[model samples]
Target: HMSFVAHSGTSAVGTKVDVHRSPTACNIPVVARRNHQSCSIVPALRYCIRNERSPKAPSARPAQDVTTSLAENLRALGADPQVILDHPDLRAADAELLTSSLSALSDWVPRRSLGALLERHPPLLTAPLGAWADFLASFGFQRLAIQELFLNSPDVITSSSVYRAGQVFLFLRQLGLRNEEIVGPIFRWRALLVEEADYQSAASFLASEGGVPDELLPRVASTYPGLLAAPVEGELRPRLQFLKGLGPEASRLLRGFLWEDWCGWIHGLANWSTAVAPKLVALEDLLPGGRPAAEALLREVPEALKCPPESRLVPNLRLLTGRMGIQGESLFVLLCGAPAILSLPPEQLESRWVFLLEAANGSKADLLAYPPYLLASLSKVTGPRFFYITLRGLTSRFMNRAFNGGDAVASESGRRGREVGAGFGIAGSNEYNLDLRWLCEGSDDEWLKRMALEQRAGPGGGGWSAAPLALVVGMAGEARTASHGQEGAKELAGQQQPQWQEAGLVKEELLLLRGDYDEVLSEWDSLLGWCCDKAFTERGCKRFEEQLSLFYLLIQGRM
Candidate 1:
């Protein structure tokens, strides 16, 4: 017994049919009915056809050989012939040509899965096999490459326009994609070959309108294959204009990053336009520099485009100006320095600011100078270092009236404190901005060395050899060991000279001189070619001495 679904529309009465058949007999028995009736036949016609079968008196009989020869040829080719025979949609496939094409491919292509491949992409069997084979071979594609191409994108076989494929392939290669690089994009976006002009126009628009250079075209195409089909006037042009409307900084940054290729750029733009933009425009009144300053802030931190204005950016701005006591041009300076602060959660930014103010003896100016301090992890670098500094008596706490009350009160206190000359010089001065700068800026070895030097001098500026140098060294070693186990501690400890070892001021002096040297070089370079016209009297002498000092430092290292 065999069971088959028979849905036929041939019946004038309009009906459905359930057809059951026996293997041996051809029994054609019709049970007739009125309008919209359904019935099943015995073994004669196992399958029903739209035009031939009477579905109102729907009956089943023996199934016919719709693709007997097609099945036989497929089975002979070592492929699943049953798939083609079983499918109702593929019932009319030309058996002779399909079989001939399969037989012809026996030499170069593997025979095993050809029928299954055709079943998946029936158009390939009907498409001119010779054209596809010739097209692949023309492009230096080997048998393996051809097989891979077909397996990766079966529809490419039906896209018989070799000229179209060649055009896109050449265009991609021109855009810096090699033969291997072209394969993945080609397979993923087969329409590149099928609709060549559309893709070419899109690529051209990216170069002409979107400002994507020739070099980045291949990357852009691969990252945003859908862009090839995106409408120029509607989607691409509007998005380009919207991004350009943000400002030169935003436009330039977006062009550099190719935001069109990024999936989230649209959503980010939406957020910026509706939420962030209004907040920034509104900031012209609230903050110092107004909308222009806000634009500059967005340029510094493009990620700010994705954040909500009221909930995220506005709150962080308030915290900086209100809680941190940063106002006017200082607020602008801080924003320009660390625009990422706008994205930080209120609690996290507040905690960091609190720690900075309390532990590091840092002021608003210090935070402005080093914006990255706001982004540093508390537990990893800030918290651990703060605890260590405080424990070693390197830092002293003073009730900052400005922070306790407001900026006005803090200003009054600072005026009185400066008048008294209360905390002056290296050891006595509680303002550890220089120390904090070095601590945060220097590497791990440098950090350990800097801490040891500060601790060695004690509370007085001239107290050299006051504190136990061995104790400082031990503390650094303990911190290193605690942070990075025995191996790291041993490596670091080995770098330091023994407590009894003779002091060396040469290296320290040289480092200070080098830092100054960099500043001078920066000033000179800032002039560009204009420096040539300047008088070379003292300039030559100053540079000569600078070189001489650097050479002396090199010699000391060798010694």
Candidate 2:
């Protein structure tokens, strides 16, 4: 029971800790109390990364007399003092290495932060951390980063080796990943950096023995980092073999998910047999095509099974069947057409459904016809473009294209068969089968340009004509007239030629042809931009055309 306190006084040593005595010393290594306060290690010390910068070097032996002094230091910083004192590794730790590790760790974080972390994981003290810091530094991490790395993954530190970390780093580098790309995944999944499994060997085996393509090697290493920890002989190989037995497509699909969505969860599965096969069964049970269809769906788009069938797939099917009246083979068709839709939030699916119902004028046929609509950004892309065309009474362009067997066959219904008459142009021809995908495929500006181009190429006529722009202006005049009687028509009398440059509408006047809109480009120029503006949309009482008509009248001479 030989217990002692470092002779604490201003003159005694490295840190001037006050001294006194009490019985609350750590259970294993008796800790002494000073002035009725439990002796905690010195709190603030110069924080630095090892070899980043060092304090005046001292003997590896702690400046304090008792080994308990080191314990006090750890306890003060927030480590569970008794855990360190009780650890067998501490007893075996070489004096030189342990001292060096502690000093490096000390410079790594603020006093209290380091203490809080060590309390959660005391065995971190048992590992040779100095070498770990050195390897991490080789990756160009700063002191703050090294500290966070330690705090984030004490489990890795407890069992990891510098050599193991290097092997993992080398694997990624060999895959052509830059150091930055390697650091991001390793930082996010710290265990990947230190686990002793031959991840490089596993990757090589996957590329050679398992048939994974070499070009995909970099992304596989960078994205599904934890896969590196899967044991080459027992775990990785066996699970991979089982997955291969299911079929090559099956293996490729789930393995792709190990990087995309549900990444961490999939890698943690015991084996595809115990964890994934059950989901496959459930997916088949829920889908109309059964197992083959479900497998085929995943083959076409590997991301479909990223979420469990019961959680994501079943609900999406219910939305289609219960909400949208999609029955039998149609449900499978929708999933296959756009496999990613299954993973969308139920609310998002509902929104696109609701939006589509309105855009197609209460029709859900397009719901099954193009499942990608379900994956579109309801607020940003689909909503803006659909409303842009619809508000102008131009949705007729995409409303009805008869199916030629399976492909779209253009029909005349889009024109309402209403001849251009005096205001709207393109009197007669017949190609109104507008594929909705064209609206969402491009950026906002691109979408606008596509709309402009389509309008320039007459709606039914299918050749260049400026009639649609004049039709848009005429349509605006019509909405206003419908709402405001003869007064709306009176507003059109005051219109003047608009300065196209000031309105931000870029196009040569030649694009207009002979039309009513040739006189006022500003009104429709701001019109498309206005459609995307929430503030503008909310403020106007009428459709965009009506508002543009009103704007044209109100701003008569300004443009």
Candidate 3:
């Protein structure tokens, strides 16, 4: 019983790698088939070539030799005989030319991958794949890498595309890097191969608008190969101009962030200047302290302008102010400390706020005192880490990473919080005593050293509870009563409740307490010694929801 095989994906756009089948698909009761194919290592394409000859016109209809081959090959591939007969071009295609094309492809691709590729892109059988293998190999692409590259972008193999791809490579080879050394990046980015990518113009832009010295142009291109394909007027110019406007350190962010992140950061609509400038200007009026304060905020945190301020940024800020009385300088400090707040959706922002208050047992004072705690991710960092701490009692393991830090910054945040709290007529020292940067910035051991000092200072109202899931997704009232009148609930509320204690709990109570988490855990279990990972995708989420439905029903006392 058991076997493994590689499967090809249908599309070239999002399907980066080939997928495979599982035993569950064959032996177990048929459920549903998976459509997304993004495996790490799967076979992709195959082809071979004979001696070069002048390209010949196709003879109408399949001759006897080609005809027998088509029927046998299609059948052997487990495809319908009618598929080839139905295609106008395939029906009329010459056997000699088809053989030559597949042969050329075989020099780079293997048989299975070639068959899979041909299934998805039948045009490859008739097109000019014969011309590309040598040219690409001259750039140092071996058989396997070439097959994967074609899978990454199959259209590059068609007729008349070679001249453009060649021009691009030659232009970039001036970077003084060996063809073999740059080959991997070329395949990954492939901007040079794109029809619209003007390598010369992008080179010129780096020299001119990009302030790249003529001496360093090659270095810049090698570092950011995709820069050759980026839309100059739309993406490149607006981002460069925006950074230059924000002062020196801010401008270096494009280089500081990872290449993919840098690209995503600069991505904007066409006519970015006309589209984005007015929005940020108008945003000044919508925020508190009006135009002057807004301009100052923009200067300090220019990345706030990454999004359309009106869409998510202002609405999220207003939600904070309207819901919890955060405005004026306090609002200013919150944004300055974590401008990424502008990018988070209003709904997710509210959920995180609730999770901090009810689940983490934090308060509005914590938000004011420690804006940095909100800087890290929620689902990836805060939510999972909070659960990990509560389940493991590793409070020392919890760390906060916020933006914009220094000793001066820490003292300034505390000073600002105190001033703002005094302005709002709230007690500042009792709750806001711990400095945000000092608490979050130091190493884990340094953070540990601060513990006795923190205890001597008294309760900062900064600890969280396993406040019911409703605190995260439902009303405060639902979180209120769900914990009481239920036996053993009080014990689990504390850190790292003992495992032996679980034996006494009623099954219904256990389900109510840990159903959602168990669902995720079960979804990932290994079967038959093979680790089967289900991605946290849409369907995976639906499965989690369905599994937890009974838990919710029991919580409502429906059964």
RMSD, every candidate, angstroms: 24.2, 19.8, 22.7
Query: Lowest summed-lDDT stretch of 10 residues in model 1?
Result: 423-432
Candidate 2 per-residue C-alpha lDDT over 1-559 given as tens digits, one digit per residue, 9 for 90 to 100:
1212344344354433222222121211111222223221221110122232234565665544446667667767767766665666566665444555667778766677877776666667666566566556545545666777787877876766554454455456667776566553237446565555666676787677655577766766666666666677876665555344444455455664442233322342333544456556755776655666655555455555567666676677777778678765555555655667767766567656754553344454545444566777755666545545654444545553431211431122112212211122212213224445555565654445445555544454254233222222213433555576676557653452222322234454324322322232333445433342322332332445564455345434321
**Could you arrange the candidates by lDDT from highest to lowest?**
2, 1, 3
lDDT of 1 by residue, 236-300 (tens): 66665655665556644554343444332432332334645565674565555555556555655
lDDT of 3 by residue, 1-559 (tens): 2222434465443322111222121121111122223322222111112323454577565578776676666566554556644566676776666666656666666655656666666666665564565545544555566677666667555433554554455466565554544566336546567777766776677678766667666656666677777777866766666545655555444233311233332323223444345556654655555554554455555555555667767677777787757766667667555556666656566755655654455666666656766655444444443443344333332322221222344455556534433332222222432223432444332232233223322343144221210111212333443555456456434533322122232334434334543443333232100111112222333555443343233223211
Provide the TM-score for each candidate, comma-separated.
Answer: 0.35, 0.36, 0.42
Top model number, TM-score: 3
What lDDT score belongs to each candidate, Candidate 1 first?
Answer: 0.50, 0.51, 0.48
Off by over 4 Å in 2: 1-64, 91-100, 184-196, 209-212, 232-559
Residue 467, candidate 2: Cα error in Å is: 57
Minimal lDDT window, size 10, model 3: 526-535
For all candidates, the clash counts are 11, 7, 14
When sorted by TM-score, best at the front, the candidate numbers are: 3, 2, 1
For candidate 2, the per-residue lDDT at 186 reads: 32
Q: Deviation in angstroms for 355 in model 2?
A: 30
